[model samples]
Target: MHNSIERTPIRAHLTDHMVIVNAQAVETGPTRRPAAVLIWSTTDQKIAFSDPKGNLLFEGKAALVAPEVIRRLRTTDSTFFSLNFEPGNRHFLPLSRLVARQDFMPLKFDRFSELSDELQSRFELADYKGIEELSDELALTLLPRTNAKHLRDERIDLLLPLLESNQPPELNSLAQMLHLSKDRLSHLFADDIGMPLRSYVLWRRYRRALLALQSGEKIATVAHRVGFYDHAQMSRTFLTLFGYSPSILKCPKFIRISGIQSN
Candidate 1:
């Protein structure tokens, strides 16, 4: 008989405005690890994600993802609990990298058709505490140096800073400065990051919009400030991302991102 495997805690990146909690639980034998949980702004709900932790996490490492179609991994059956984090985009990761995945599967970790055993084990569990640590570990570990893709790195670098700017710049300008065609830029983004540039842009913007709302801004004002099309636009994206409306997440209301609100 084999002894049970135990995992330590990991780190996660965070915004001054937002907080991220890592996945925590213990399960045994093949079980579904929790995917991502996104909480958008105040609308109907935010679009929760279960994708690759984004390209930033796969920087300069030689890790492995479970392949494209494998989907989520099954927790050891002996006894294992999980602690899931929230609010990020969704992407399919190979065993080289560690990321949150969805339920849809032919579950896999390392090589497919070889589960209910020890094959796909990649995350650096240091100390299971909070979000900042998890985000940091993720950023540091997953995103190592792959190759010389300055533009790709540069583009991703823009995100944290751009979001911090008082008046964040638009995408077209960045594309222009990079001296690359729009399609080409998008292609590079997808290549390095997995998802298209526009998709991450949306996630980044929506994250900001939610922050504004959390600060007690009006719907219209928050929408305008965060560069949304309008309140309706914010509302729709909120619902899409969080699975709840914007008005509900207010501080006093204090809505939890995990629950499903009834009509």
Candidate 2:
């Protein structure tokens, strides 16, 4: 059994809500709805991704994944690069805006030339510091309309840290923290971040669970630690997000380019 394969975490520049990862998965199997700007280094990669209703969202090399859906990869052993935007993350609005329209959007390869080049040239040869520097550079380049200040949302800025806690704040409690009604907060969250509060919360929990499992924590322990009801609950979330059981994280080939600290 391949258990908890290790790879150095890819360090990214600190930005509220945006996530960047440069990872390589070797036959790592299918992944769930990843909310990020996913650029795979493969030409004409056949992908069959869909919403919960099974509606086809994309079939291409690069696609922006919105939170809370299920998608399948057609291949493994490929370089996977992504920049995910969360609430309080105003840096990648162009990418976020695309995810807002639907579950996923097919992107042209040229959209990520610098990131792709860096991944190819330095990903294998670079040391941790070099990867960290490259990741910072990549994050800077991914900002949309770099000259304009990101559209800041104080509500989300306050909300992100809460979402990272072991027990996510209740929506009503979160709204109270932001001084808004739950309904109003939900609408604004969807409007600004392009996904509902519940979905984002689920995705955040799912991410924590993945990292924990990868670190070799037992499934039950990870589930409880990350605020899932149980191992089953965590597994369900994984199934919902990755279209596979959480055990896939246990795969011998599983390789992670860790995103920023969430635990």
What would the per-residue lDDT of candidate 2 be over residues 1-263, giving only the tens digit for each residue?
11224543322222335445555432223455535554455434444454445456576667667654455443344455655555445434555554666767666666565557665565556444555555456545544554565564776767777888888889988889889999999898877766788877877787777667767778898898888889888887776654457776545354443445547
In model 2, the worst 10-residue window by lDDT is 7-16
Give the root-mean-square deviation of each candidate in angstroms. Answer: 13.1, 5.1
In angstroms, the error of model 2 at 193 is 2.5
Which residues of candidate 1, in runs, are more than 4 Å off? Answer: 1-13, 16-19, 22-130, 134-152, 155-172, 256-263
Residue 1's lDDT in candidate 1: 9
How many Å off is the CA of 182 in candidate 1? 1.7
lDDT of 1 by residue, 152-183 (tens): 35565555355444355566766786676777
Q: Pick the candidate with the highest lDDT.
A: 2
Local distance difference test, each candidate: 0.38, 0.60
Q: lDDT, candidate 1, residue 49?
A: 18
